[model samples]
Target: MGKTYLYLLIAVAFEVFGTSCLQASQQLTRLWPSLGIVVGFGGAFFFFMQVLKELPLGITYALWSGLGIILVSISGWVVFGQKLDLAALLGIALIIAGIAVINLFSISSPH
Candidate 1:
């Protein structure tokens, strides 16, 4: 359902926020970023729980974590000046392909 995917998108956004804050936290030394970690992940789990009501765990996790990795990787590159070499780019491409396969073809994924 549309609501299910919306919840999943919110969850992924919070997770990406949490992960981005984690990098900015500097090993948890920075105060604001550390708090962001708590709030971001907290919101992530809260909304993710809402999603669990409609979707199976394995499929949800695959989509959640897959999108998270891709977004976080981009955030790291753009916000943190991190590099994505050829191998890393290839890996990310593979991740995208895997997610596409799951969403487009896997019977378990929600329509």
Candidate 2:
């Protein structure tokens, strides 16, 4: 993978971690956990900003935000016993496909 993709991955990984931590942080009861989430999110956003240098804002942001939401939701289902029905799963799949299409086929990307 290219540097841009690597950076994007880093951002995603950190963001997922942060989001998971946020869940652990319940109503300020888990202050330390919440602090960790803030730190993780800050780092992820920093890497995301770096990735933006090599890709179009619309394309990069679309994939980043879309994939991140799906991953976070999936994580919630798996880790927290949250309900994920067929529709949500299919929607996540569609989002992934959309990101793939944007990255692999669309000439709309500035890169």
Candidate 3:
């Protein structure tokens, strides 16, 4: 279970990197950032597949996407100077709450 979580964390990190690179890619026009998208997403999917071996799809996807969204948003805000409005912050907070609930209470997920 700990190994599963490590895989999930790695997957999320790669996903966030991919998403960040996607923004930096500038519509796929830039060279390094565009290549980074491929490498990041590829690594993400590879590790995500490992995670899926131990966890259910629905729960895994929820956790994966939730963390990815939060990390990517932060990356955008900090690295790209993107704006995060009050509503967006509220939404992110809600996502955090949802993830907490899942980790805390959901039997389908490993505690």
What range of 10 consecutive residues in model 2 has the weakest lDDT sum? Answer: 102-111
How well does each candidate superpose onto the true structure, as a TM-score? 0.96, 0.90, 0.97
How many angstroms is residue 111 displaced in model 2 relative to the true structure, after the best TM-score fit?
6.8
In the range 1-111, model 1's lDDT, one tens digit per residue, is 899999999999999999999999999999999999999999999999999999999999988999999999999999999998999899989999999999899988767
Candidate 1 runs further than 4 Å off: none
Q: Model 2 over residues 21-110: C-alpha lDDT tens digits?
A: 889898658988788798879989999999888887888889788878988998898999899889888898899899888877899774
User: In candidate 3, which residue ranges exceed 4 Å CA deviation?
Assistant: none
Cα RMSD for candidates in order: 0.8, 1.6, 0.7
The models' CA-based lDDT, in order, is: 0.95, 0.86, 0.95
Q: Rank the candidates by TM-score, best first.
A: 3, 1, 2
Could you tell me how far off, in angstroms, the CA of residue 37 lies in candidate 3 after the best superposition? 0.5
lDDT of 3 at 64: 98
Single out the weakest 10-residue window by summed lDDT for candidate 1: 102-111
